[model samples]
Target: MAHITIYTTLLCPYCHMATNLLRKKNAPFEEIDVTARADLREAMRAKAAGRNTVPQIFIGDEHVGGWDDLFALETTGRLDAKLTPRSD
Candidate 1:
């Protein structure tokens, strides 16, 4: 299975949208809620390179940025490609 990770908050609409899109693709993901966790929130900002925003996503080890980036990947039909684990 593909390792999809998303840092999100309960009140963030963009995070919900991102998760919704992933659900549409039948992709399983780990949703880390950063609302109540200060450590995770700081980690998200660091991992995202100072982008202190909700919904920092990662497909495997590749950092896919925020909701907009994920949407772009979907629109370009590359989301599935990234979601598929390599056999070789």
Candidate 2:
């Protein structure tokens, strides 16, 4: 399976929802709580192109954006494709 990583905040509703969807899909992910880690906040911003919002998601180096983007991918049926393990 592709590795999932989400930079999240402790009390963000979108963060909770994003994680929930991943769980429902039975996907294992690395949840990095950036609520308290200012260090991580800067790192997340750099990678996310200044998107300093909660729940910045990445699927094996592919940026999936925030919760809404996640839902869009799921609705369009492309999320499963992104989650599948690549032969590389």
Candidate 3:
């Protein structure tokens, strides 16, 4: 599986939803709470191309954007290929 990282805030509903979707799909991910870390929040903003939003998701070095984007991918039937573990 690809390395999944999500930049999130404590009180963000989208963040929770995003993580919940990942959990439901059994996708492995690391959650970074940017609300408690100013530097990480700034980094997330930079990665998001100046959009200061919660739940900025990255899947294997690919910037997958926010919760809406993630859900969109699933809806479009593209998220599984990126999330499924590769067999050597």
**Which predicted model would earn the best lDDT?**
2
Q: Model 3: how far is 69 from its true place, Å? A: 0.3
Q: Which predicted model would earn the best TM-score?
A: 2
Off by over 4 Å in 2: 86-88
TM-score of every prediction relative to native: 0.93, 0.95, 0.91
Model 1: per-residue Cα lDDT over 1-88, one tens digit each: 6899999999999999999999988999999999999999999888888888889998998899999999999899888889997789
Better TM-score candidate (1, 3): 1
Model 2: per-residue lDDT, tens digit, 1-88? 8999999998999999999999999999999999889999999999998999989999998998999999999999999989995576
Global lDDT scores for all candidate models: 0.92, 0.94, 0.91
Q: After superposition, how far is residue 36 of candidate 2 from its true place, in Å?
A: 1.9
Clashing pairs in 2: none
lDDT of 1 at 8: 97
What local lDDT does model 2 show for residue 14?
98
**Residue 44, candidate 3: C-alpha displacement in angstroms:** 0.9
Error of 3 at 29 (Å): 0.4
Number of clashes recorded per candidate: 0, 0, 0
